[model samples]
Target: MAKGKGKTKGNGRSKQSPQNPPPPSQCETLEEDEIIRCGEPAADGPRCKVHQAQYRTLYAKYKAAGKVVDETKAGMEMPSKEHIAQYSNLHSTLEKARRIRKYLEAIRVEKAGRDMHQKRFFAKADDGHKIRLKVLEKQMSAAVEILDAVQARAFDLHMADDPAREWVKNFQAAPLSTNDEEFFSAINSLESETDPQRDIMKQQRVAAAATTNDDTMDADLIDIEMRAKKASLLYVFEFVTSEEATLQCMREFLGPENANIGAKSSLSYHTLCQYYRRIVMHDPVLSLKAINKRRMHVQFEVLMDKRMDFGLLLWKDSIIEAMAITRSKAGTAANVGDPKNRFKVLGGWVFNTPHSGTMSNETWGTLLETLAPIEANIENRFVRLCNTFDDLITYLSFGALGLFPPPRFCSKTDAQGRDAVAPRNHLSLCGCSVNYNFLYLGHHPLRDEAGPQGASYGLKWRNGLTYLELFEMSPMHLQMHSYPDSGQDLIYFQVVLYSDTDSKDKFECFGSGNEALPAIQTRTFEGPPASVTNLPSGRGEWEVQLSASDLLFGTKQPEPGYLTLLTRPGSSGWFFHFKKMPVKYFVILDTVPHRHHSILAKHVAWTALCTHGFGEGEYSNRKYARASDVMFQKRAEELLSWKPKGSWTATKMGD
Candidate 1:
C-alpha cells in the first residue's frame, strides 16, 4: 500500500491520462435548420442511422427533380430508393385504374343480375319494390356515368405521351377490313416508352366500348386500325431492314411523288408491296422467277358452258322459291307459284392460265390501272387472270356449276309487270347467295339503284378473261402469257409444277409427284338426288361433306354456347353434329331473293324475344303411350330381326 501511494508522484497533475477523453458525443449530426439530432451514433459512419435515412431521402428527392450532376455544384447527389419509388407513383395510378376497370368488367355476372333484378322489381308495380327498383336503377346509371368519365380521362392520359400518339397515327392510317385476318402476328414488334403500361390501357380501350352500340361502326373501324397497325409493323419488320427503312418507303410511295395515283391510294398497301420488293431485290434467297410463279402471280380460269358452269351458286329465283316454300311449310302465308329456273350451266371447267393476246387489251388496261399502284414495286409486275388464287378455287364450287346468263335490258314492262333495270356489271345472273367471287363475277343487286360509280377493284376485268387480274404491267407478264405453262395437272397439285415458288400456306393434296397427279381422281353426281320413301331421323345425311374434325361437337362434350356456320348467298352451307344428344334444334337465316333484297334480313322480333328469355314457343305434348304397360313393346314379325339390342342401340339411319 505504501509503495503504490508513492509511485503516483511522477506526472502528478491528476495524471488520469485526461480520463481517456470522453468518447465523442453519441449523437447524430444536426441538420442545418434543425436544433436537435438523433440521440445515438450510427453503428457505421459519422451520422446516426436516422440522419443517414434522412439524408438519403433528401438526396433522392433532389435527383428525382431530373437535376443533372455538375462537379461545380456543391450539394449534388444521387436519388435514394424512396425517391425512385415516388417518381414511379405517377404511372402506377394509371395502371391501377386499368386493373380496376378490368376487374369490373370481369365481374359482369353481378352487374347483369343486378340489372335483371331491377327490371323485374320495377315490373312488380308494388310501391315498395318500385321505389327500391328506381333507386337501384339510379345507382346503376350514376355508376355508368362515373365509369365513362374515368375511361375518357384514362384515354386522354394515355394520348398525352408521344409514343401513344405515334401508335394511334399509324393505326388510323391503315385499317384492316372484315375480310382480313382476325389477328396480327406483329403486334409486339415495336417497343414503346410507355409500353410498361400499354397492356392495361389496351384492355381498357377495348372494354370501354364493350357495352356501347350506337358507335359500333366507329369502334369497328378503330379495331380495324389497331389490327392494321400490328400487321403493318410485323410486315415491315419481316421485309424491311428496319423501321426507318419502312418509314422512308412509305413516305416515297404515299407522298406527292405519286400525284397521278388515285385519291384512294393505300399507304399501308404500298408500304407492304415496297417492303416485298426491297427484300426480293436484296435477299439472295429470293428469285424473280419463283415470285412470278406464286399463286398471287399466276392467273386462274374456269371453263364455262351452257349447263355446267353457273356463274354463281344460289340462283336468285331458287333462293326466293326456297324461302317461299319454307315459309309456307312453316304455316306462314306466301305466294305459292313456282319460281322459273333461269340458271343454265352444267360441267366442271378446265383451270389454266391464258396466253398473251388471249386476254383483251381492255382487260389488261383496266388491270394495269387498277393494280398498278399495288404492284408498282414488284420485281416482275404482272396482271395474271386469276387476280387472286382464291378467286379460281372459289368460283368453281357447287353453286357455280349451274351458271346463268345475264339478263337483257328491257325498257318496257316484262311479263311479270315489272320493268327491268339496265345491266350494270358483267355477271349474267340476277344474284347469287353464296358465291365466293360474287363481288367480281356477278352484278350487285343494287347496281341499278346506285349511280354511275366505278366498279369495285375485283370486277374490272374484260369479258374475254375467265379470271380477274390483280397486277399491272411488268416484264414477267409478257413471259407468262407467251409460255402459258400448261399440261401441269393443276387439279392434283395446288401450285404450278413449272416453277420453284413455295406455297403461301400448308395445303393438303393426295399423291406425291407427277405420278400422284395422274393418279388423283374425283367423282361427280349428275341430276337430282336419289329420292327416298321414308326419311331417317336426326339429320340423316348432310348436304355438305365436312370432315368430322370440322364439326363443333366432333370429339367434345356438349358446350353451353351454340356454333356458327359462315354461309354464303348461293351455297347450301352444311354442319354435321356427330354427337347424339337428348334433343335437336334448328335455326334458319333466310335471305330475300330480289333485285332490291340485297340487304341481309335480320330476325329482329324473334331475336328480341329470345334475348328476353321468351325463346321459341311451346310445341305440342304427345299423349300416346305403349299399349302394353311393359317397358318394351313388341315389333312386327318382319321387323323383328332389325330390333336393337338395348335402349342405346338403334337401327341404321340416313336420308
Candidate 2:
C-alpha cells in the first residue's frame, strides 16, 4: 500500500511540473483593442497586475465623485469619471474651435466678396461701411485668438483612449469644416440622444451633457473678453494714433476758439507739434523718443550690440528743438484776403532786371504795355512780381523755335514718281510703312489793320503752297533763313522730319512703295519771293521732329487743329499748339541709326501728342487756354539716361 501511494504522488507531482503544467487562469481585463481580453494570468482581481492597478484607480475616481463603485463588479476596462470628464471637455473645446474657425472663414469670404465687388465697379465704401468692416476685422482677430486657445486646451486633454479623445485627434489631423450645414449637423447629432445612427453618440450621454454645459457659457462673448484682456502696449499705441483720439487732442490743445474744427478741417503741422509737446511728451506711459528707440532696436538687433555705443537717447530739449525746426520748415502762410498782403507774405527775394535802368522810357513803356494783359490774368500776384511776364515771353520764343509740327500725309508714289492709289482708311493709312522727311514751317499772316497788306507773292495760301516751298529746301538752307515778313511773330514756328538715310538725298524716305497709304495729296509751294536775295535769313533755329504714327494713330490721338494756349509763364505753349496742327504725312522710322536722337524725337512727339483735350464745353482752341508746359518738358527729360548729380567716385572721396 505504501509503494502504491508513492507512485500516485509522483504522478501528481509530474502533472504539476513546468513541462506538464495544469490549465492557467486568464485575466478578464480587456486589451487596448477592447474586443480582446487580457491573456495574462489573473492577479489581485479579475485582471492582470497592470489592469488590477487601473481598476483600483478607476474605483477611487468613482468614490471621489460620490458614486459607489461595487469593487466586486468593477471592470478594469471601464473608464474613470475623470477620464470621461476630460474627454467631454476636449470634445467641447474642439467643437467650439471648429465653429469659431468656420465663423472666421465666413467673415473672410464676405470681406473678400465685398473687396472684389468694390474693385470690379471702382466703388468706394462710405464711412459707415468702412467702420463696419473694421469691426468685423477686429471680431475675426478675436475669434482666431479664442480658437487657438481652445485648440491648445483640447490637445492637453486629448490623451485618453475614449471616443471624444479619438475625435479630437482626428479633428487635429483634418482641415476645419468649411460647410456650415455639415458643421451644425455634426453638433446637433452629438447633442441629441434621438440620433442612434452615430456610434460615438450611442456610446454614452457624456458628449450631450458637455454640449448642455457649453450653452451656459456664451462662446460669442469669449472673444470679446479675450480681446479686452490682451490690451497691451501695442493696443495703447494704436488707441493714441487713432484718428478720433488725435483729432480730440488737437481740439483740446487749440482751446475753445477752435472747437468748431471738425475731422474734415485741415490741421496745421504747427498745431500737431504743439499738441505733441503738451500732451504726448508729458504722458506718463508713452514717450515718442523711447518708442522710436525701441522700434529701431527691435528692427535691427545689431544696433543693440554691447560694443556699439549708439547715442539714441537724446535730451528732451534737443528733440523739441528738432521738432520746432521741422515745424518752421513745413510752415505755410495762411490764406490772406488782400492780394498785396498775400504776395508780400509768400514772395521770395527779387532782383531788378538787367535792363531795368538802361532801357529808354518809350521801350520800357512798350514792354510794360505788352505785359499788362499778362499780369492782369495771373491769379498769383507773387508770380507777376517775380518777372514771370518776361520769363513767359522768353520761354514762348524759345519753344516756338523748337516746336515740332504735326505730321502731314501724302499719296505714295511709285519708283517713276507716278501716284499709286490704294484703299484709304485711318488704319490702312496709319499702317503704311513708306514715309518721307520734309521741313515744315508754319506762318500766320499779319492782320491788315496792323501792317500793310502784302501780296501773296505768287503763292496760293489755300493750297499750303508755302509749306511745299519750304519742303523743297535743304534743312541747312532752311536753318539759315530768317522769319517770314508777313508772318506774326507769335505764330511762326519750324519743324524738321527726322530721317536715318545718309544717301546723298537729304530727304530720307522709309519703307517699300507697295504699302497702303493715306488719300491726302500735297503740292509744294508753286511761287517765289519777289527777290530771293532780299528774303529774311540767318535766324536762330531749333529742330523738332515727330513720328507720323504717334502723332495721328497713337493711344491718344491729338485732335485735328487742336490749339493749346499759354496761361502760365515758362510753359511749352507753342510746342503744345504746334503738335496738334491738322497737317498729316508722317510715319515711324524704326531703323534709324541715331537711336538717342530717334528716342528723343519720339519722346517729345508723344508728349505733345498725348496731351488731353479740353473737356466738353471747354474751349480747347481758345487764345488764352491753360496748358502744362512743365509737364511736357518733364516728360521729355525723363526719356534721357539718368546721370548722378556728381561723379560717384568723387562723391565717395569727398571731392
Candidate 3:
C-alpha cells in the first residue's frame, strides 16, 4: 500500500508551497516619474540583477545630493533651487581657496629664487625692489587670511566632519604665541585640504608587480658578471700597473692633438711620467722632503745674497718664457737689454708676483721691502711699472693662467702716444681679486688704478706669536674702530684640543660630578680681563693675550700646538695656522687687498710641517705600514702567477 502511494508522481510537477516558492517574472523598478514599472524578469530579487544595481546607484546619488529617497516607489525627490544654489556657492568658495593657496606657494618659490640670486651675486636689492617684495608678501598674507576666514565660515555653516573642516577647527582653536617654533609647529600640524592625495598602498602594489622574477634574475646576473670581471687576470694586471690607464687620463686632459703629438714623437709615456713627478712635487703633504730641501737653500743663500724664494724664481722663469713666446709671435725687435725694457721686465715681475693675483698681503709686504728700493728712478719708475704691468696682464690673458684683465687696465697708450680704447668685452675681476692691490697698502693708495669705483676693501695681517709672548702680554686691549657701512666687529678666540688617550681627559668638569666625558674640549675667550692685553703698537694694534693656564692642560709643559692668526678687515677674514709660533709679539697690521695665493701657501706650509715627521719617526715602525705593503705585493704576485693548469695557493710572501 505504501509503494502504491509513493508511485504517485504524476506529471513530475511540485505544488507552489512556502518552501518551494514560484519563480519571479517581472522587475519591480519604477521610472523616474514613478509612473511605469520595469517588467524585466527578476533573477534573484524583486527586480532583475541589472535593475537592482541601477536602483542602488540612484539611492546613493539621492543621499549624496542631500535629498530623501522614497523606498516604496523607488524614486528620488528633486533638489530645491535654494539647495542647488548653496551647493554651487560652496564648491566655488572651495575652488577659490585652493587657487589662492596655489598662487601664494608660487609667489614664495619666486621670492626664494630672487633671494638666492641676491646672495650669490652679492647684489643689494634696490629700495623699490625691496618695497615691491614686501607688498607681494603682504598681498599673499592677506589672501591666505581671506581663505582661512572663508574656510572657517564654511565649517560653521555646514558643520561637516572632513580633513579640511577639522583642520580649520583646530587652527582657530590654537593659541597665538610669540615663540616662532610653537606657532610654526601648530600650523604644520594642521592638514591642508588642497594637498595632493597619496595612495601609498596602491603605489606599493604597483612597484611590487613591476619588479618581476626576470628583473631580479638580471640584477643578480649583473652582480655575478662584475665579480667575475674583477677576478680576471687581465683586470688584476691593469689594476696593479695602471700604465695604460695613466696614459689615457693624460690624453684626456691634454686633448687629442697634444696627445697625438707626444705619441708620434714616442714620448707619451715619458711625458706622462714627467707630469706625474711634477704633480707629486707640487703636493704639499707628500713632498715635504722636497720643500725642506728648498728651505735649506734659503738658509744657505746658495744663489745670491738675496735670492728669490722658490715660488718667486719659478714665477720669474715662467714670465720670461711667456715674454719670449709673445715676442716671437709679435716679431718685436725690442730686446731685454735696453734699460727701459729691463726696468719694464722687472716691474712686470714685481707687480704680478707676491702682490698681483691671489698673493697674501703679508707676502706682498715682504716682497715690496726687497724690490721697491730697486726702482732708483722714482720719476719715470711709476710710468715704466704701469706699462710693464699692462704688458704682463695682456700676456697672462692670452698665454698661461688665462686671466681676464679688468676694464680699467684695458685702456692704454698707442704707438702714437694717443689714448687707445679697447673693447670692454671681458668681465673685471671681483672685489676679492682687486683687494690685493699693493698700492692700497697706504704707501701709494692714490696709485690704485685697478680699484673699482664705490667699492670699499681692506686687508689685515697677523704674525704667528708664541705661547711665551702671549703669556707676557696681560689685560688684552682692543681698539674699537667704527665702520659706518659694516656691522659691529665680533672678535673672539677659540681654543680646541683633543687628547691622544682616553685616560687623559682634554676637558675637565665637562658634565656633573663623576660623569665620564669625551677626550675633547673647546673654550671661547672674549671680552676684557680674559684674553686681551694693553700692549698696543703706535698703529692702533689690538693685543690678545693668553696665559699658560688659559692654554695649557693643568701643569703640563708646552707641547706642540698650532696657532691660527685670523685678522678680518671687513666683516669676513681668513686664518692661517702656524705649526710653531715664535714671534715676540702678535701684530694685527691693517693693509689692503690680496686673494687666494697666500691662503694656498700657508695651507701647504702647514701640511708640510704636520706630515714631515711621519716618514722617519717612531710612528713609521708600526706593523700596518710594512705589513700592508707586503700583503699588497703578495696579492699582486699571486694574481700575476695565475696559470690555466695550476691550482691556487695561499702561501705568504717573505719580507
Candidate 4:
C-alpha cells in the first residue's frame, strides 16, 4: 500500500519528469513574492514565464540603476553592463558605466521634452507651412500624435452634401468681428479622397509601359550621333564641338510645372507642378555643347575662328544683348498724375550692325538717327550706346568661356528631314523624325502699374507649344498675351530675321491683332533645326553637319539673323504711329503641340527604362515642382546598360 501511494503521487497524480518537481498540493502553498525577491525561480510557472513579476522588475533595475530610463522609452531600452557584455566584453568598470548611463539618460529625457515642445510651438506659429522634425525625436513624437488625431477627425468629415461639413461646404474664412477683433486666421487645405478607378487605371498604364518594348531609344540615340552634324548645315551653321556632360544639366532644370506661364507668373511650386504635369511630362533630347559656358563672366573679350584660324577681333564689341533689360520711367515719368517708377525693356542685343553686316560709326549713326524718332527714350539711348558695336569680339578668344547655354536641342537631320517627313495621312506616317524645341526661360515678374497702357516683353509674350511655324524669316504679328487682350498699346515691328532670301515670303501674324492686315514680317528667314542638312550620308558626299550659327555660302546674313530684338530699351515714350522697320525682331512665332497632344496620341509607343526624356515619345509633362524633380532621378544615358541587380541604397527614414 505504501509503494502504491508513492507510485501514484509520482506518476498518476503529478507525472513529474526527472528535471521537474512535483506540483504543489492543495494543502501546500508558496510565496511567489518571496521567491522572486530571492532571485530564485517563480513558486509556480510554465518554464519561460515570468509570473512573479518581481524578477522582471529586478532585471530592469540594472538599466534603471544605470540611470538610463529616466525619461523616454528609448532611455529605458538602453542596455546595462550585462547587455553590453552580450555584444562583446566591455571590460569597463561597472560603477563608471552606471554613472555614464545615468548622465546620458538625463540628457535624453531633457532633449526629448524640449523637442516635443518646439514642434508644437513651430506648428502653431507657422501660417500653414508644414514643419518636419529635422533632428528632434520628442518633437516628432508630438507631431505624430497630432497627425494621428487629425487623420481620425479627417475621415469623419462629411461629404459635400452633409450639413455637418459646414466649414468645408461654406469654405470661407470668417470675417473680422468687432468683438473678436481677430486680424488673421489660417485653415487647412481640404483634400478629397482619390478615385479608385483612376488609381487602377494608373497602375494598369504603368504596368503596360513597363512591359512595352523600347527599341526607339536606341534608334533615337544612334540616329542623333550619326546625324548630329548633318542638320547644322541646312541652317548654314557648321558643326562645332560636342559635349555629352553639358547635356546632363537638365536634372536640376526640372520643375513640376509644364509652365502654364500666365501674363503674371504667380504660382507656387505645387500649383506649377500640377499645371506642368498636365502637359509637359518628359524632357526631350538636348545637347548643350555649342553654347559658350563662360560668356556671362567675361562680358567683353575676343575670340578666334576655329576654321579660319584668325583672330576674331573686337571693335568696342557692344553686341546688343537684350535678355533682362529692366523697363523703367527712371521713376514715374509716365502718368504724371501718379508718377511712379516704370521698369521696361531696352530690346535684344545686336552683334555688329544689329543684323549680320558691318555698321561703321557713320552708317550706324544715320540709322540710329532714323530709329530714335520712332523709339522710346530708353531704346534710343541703348542704340546710341552701340557706337562701338562689333561681333568680331568673343569671350572664347580672350580666355573667358562664358556660362554655356542650358542643354538645348543641338538638332541634326536624320537620313531624312522635316520636309522629308512622310505625312501621317493615309495611315502611313513619315519615317523622318523632325523635332523643334524652345527654352521658355520662366523668369519671375511683377507689374506695378495699376492700369497702365504700356506692355512688358518677357512679362507678356507668346509661348507656343507646337512647331506649326518654327522657321521665322517672315514677320508674324503676336499679341503680348496668350489670349488676346483688348484696348490700348498695339505692337508692330518690321522683323528682318535675316536676309537668307525669298522676298516673296510674307509673314502671317498669329494671335491678337484687330487690324485688317494681320500679317507681320513678309519673310520666312528659315532657322530650321540642323535636321535639314542631316540627309542620308550616301558615300563620301553625305557627311552630317549641323549648327545654330552656321554660316551659309554666298550670304553674310546670320541664319538666325543678328541679335534679334523682341523689344528695344524699356522706353517710357509711347507712339501711336505704328512702325517697326530696319529694327529686326526675332520673335518665336509658332504654336508647338503640348505634351498631352503628343503623348496620348501615341498610346502604343513603348517607353524606355531610362528616366526623363530618354524614353521614346517621352512627355516631360509635369504639374508640380516635386514631380519634375522626381522625373529627373534616372536621367542618365547609361540606364540602357544598367541592370536591376542591387536593391535601393538604404536611406534615413523621414522623421
> All candidates' lDDT scores?
0.26, 0.30, 0.29, 0.23
Off by over 4 Å in 4: 1-16, 19-655
TM-score of each: 0.17, 0.17, 0.15, 0.16
Off by over 4 Å in 1: 1-126, 159-423, 426-655
lDDT of 1: 0.26
Clashes per model (N, Cα, C within 3 A): 23, 16, 10, 79
Each prediction's RMSD over C-alphas, in Å, is: 34.1, 29.2, 35.6, 31.4
- Give a tens-digit lDDT track for model 3, residues 486-594: 1111111111222222233432221223221211222222211222354222222224322222332333222111121122233122111111111111111111113
Write candidate 2's Cα lDDT for 297-401 as tens digits: 111111111111111111111222223333354433222122232111001110111111122222222233222333211112211211222332222222222
lDDT string for model 1 (517-630, tens) is 211111221222122332112212223222211221122222111232323232222211221111111111112222221111112222222233433442111101111111
Error of 2 at 17 (Å): 33
Query: Cα lDDT of model 3 overall?
Result: 0.29
At residue 256, candidate 1 shows an lDDT of 51
Best by lDDT: 2
- Can you give the lDDT of residue 512 in candidate 3? 23
lDDT, candidate 4, 137-227, per-residue tens: 4433433333322222322221224343343222212211111011111100100122455335434443343332212212222122223
